[model samples]
Target: MKDDRCEGVIKDAWVEQHWGNPINRLVTKVEACYTKLKTWNRTSFGHIRSLLEKKRKLLAQAEALLMTRRNHEQLRTLKGEVYELMVKEDAMWHQRLRVEWLKAGDLNTSYFHSRATQRNRRNFISKLNGEDGQVVEDEQKIGEMMASYFSELFTTAAPSDLDPILQGIERKVTPQMIQELTREYTAKEVEVALKQMKSISAPGPDEGLHALIKQAAAIGTISGVSLCREGPKVTHLFFMDDSLLFCKANSHECNSVLELLEKYERASGQRINQDKTQLFFSSNTNQQVRNSIKGRLGVAVSHQFDKYLRLPSFVDRGKKQSFSYIRERIW
Candidate 1:
């Protein structure tokens, strides 16, 4: 009976091993099928090619679906984060505006002091003559006296309550009135007005010459003026003069820098002769000259100035167009 029981147990164990779990058996069968499919070719004796094509299509679809879902979830998360940031930024801006309004209400004493000082200097220079040197004592004393006089003048000044003579002057020369006068005046009228003005406040020609000579002498005495900073270190770059005022971050950056420089010149009462300025950038290896320039303050380098042997066919247009025009046509 014991021997019979042992045999039955062995048989049961073998059956269990052979059967296993249905899920595990299915997985093993799938793996075997995959391996066979991978190894199979035209010589294989199964429908492996058709089966592989079907499996591949199914896998591709599954992967595409997963990718789409992931991208959607990521985009939603980013949008929510961006919205939160914007709300915070708006709150900060509102807080800043309130602070600015409060600050604006306070007396800006430093601003007034600097402005008053500059105005005093200007007025002193306007009225000053060499004969008044004794009255001023010294240059430093003159500056202090001018400041004090201006301070007193400002203290005594009334708002729109000018003396009749000053009021008449204001009535005649309101900014709008001046603008209208300017519009009405012809070149001949302007010339006549200037002549009358010069006659009324004329310095002798000798005195004018002496003043100009003094100015020249003063400028000549300024011995320690320095030049602008050194140019950039890029190999393919060149500058026409010592004006390191321009920058070339890239093609776009270069254009922007040129525009900014032009704007600055307008604002600062300076002029830029673009005809004299040289701009350089890398182009195709076969292009002619490494540098080019444009006439006047134009930022667009002329095609004629470009020496690149492999000049793009589209660059022949005489009119200035966007860089995109050249890029699209060339590349």
Candidate 2:
């Protein structure tokens, strides 16, 4: 309800009201059962089962009585209670089942129940495909495989000549483009961005009051930095502290893109963590080509990739494949 970070912070009552979560209904159901079970003189499983049956019969009788009486106020109260119970049940099943992308709604409890089971099953990695074309089922061996794979991935490679590819391309960025890209960050603009972020993301944030000072300093540094994409025709995406650069696979294009990144780092007093950077190769790119690309950028090459923006960036993303993650939310 209250936070040490900021005075009079977000409270559970407000969240339950605004978020439309059926907290009261859930408590009503579970608390009654918990209390009844606790107070019972017997402690055996058989007695517990009988107690549960008794509770259900009592609820059923109460419902039947309210229906037969047909008092308008009673009917309305009972109807509202039943709806709340339904909502609470839906929310419970959804939470327990761990449905990531779907909200609790009509008739999804049964589906969520099954997905929870599937999630549990899928989490257990009984086997893994090793890079050496060997099946590794042992947990220790899987750990070893991952550690070794990533070690080689982040390690710096021997330098190779990038001059050949750099010579092959013509410059697309001219003086006008350079002038536009050279736009600097102003303190006023930085303050506006910080204020906007505070309003939207400050309440019930990841880390509470203690993080305010840290966030201000970090965000201030971030605000002082600015980087625009190479050309108006190019598409560049930025999220959080991450940046993604898209360009032609050719070496000239790659070199140009890298150069722009380097310039941005120097200008903004920020640097990219090359050890964590990765370069994904197309299916058609041979080992020799991939190696050359990695050498130039000092980035690791990855044949397989995972989700970004909750969507998979697979090597062979076909029309059907592109929408596969969407199917997960359909339930």
Most accurate candidate by TM-score: 2
In model 1, pairs of residues that clash are 274-296, 287-308, 287-309, 288-307, 288-308, 288-309, 289-307
Residues 97-149 of candidate 1: C-alpha lDDT, one tens digit per residue? 33323232233335544554565666555233333455444777667777875
lDDT (CA) per prediction: 0.41, 0.54
Candidate no. 1 TM-score: 0.16
- Off-target runs (Cα >4 Å) in candidate 2 are 1-55, 62-83, 95-109, 120-256, 259-290, 302-331
Error of 1 at 316 (Å): 30
Report the lDDT of model 1 for residue 96.
Answer: 28
Write down the lDDT that model 2 would get: 0.54
Per residue, candidate 2 scores C-alpha lDDT tens digits across 1-331 of 0113221122222233222357866665455554544443223232433444455565566667875675666556555555554555555455546545656455345667688778878787788897678999898998888789777654544324433334333468999999987899789987787776622244331211112222322333212113355533323455665556555466765676565455444433345678767787657778787777788888876545566666665635375767765787796
**Clash count, one per candidate:** 7, 1
Off by over 4 Å in 1: 1-241, 245-251, 283-331
Error of 1 at 152 (Å): 43
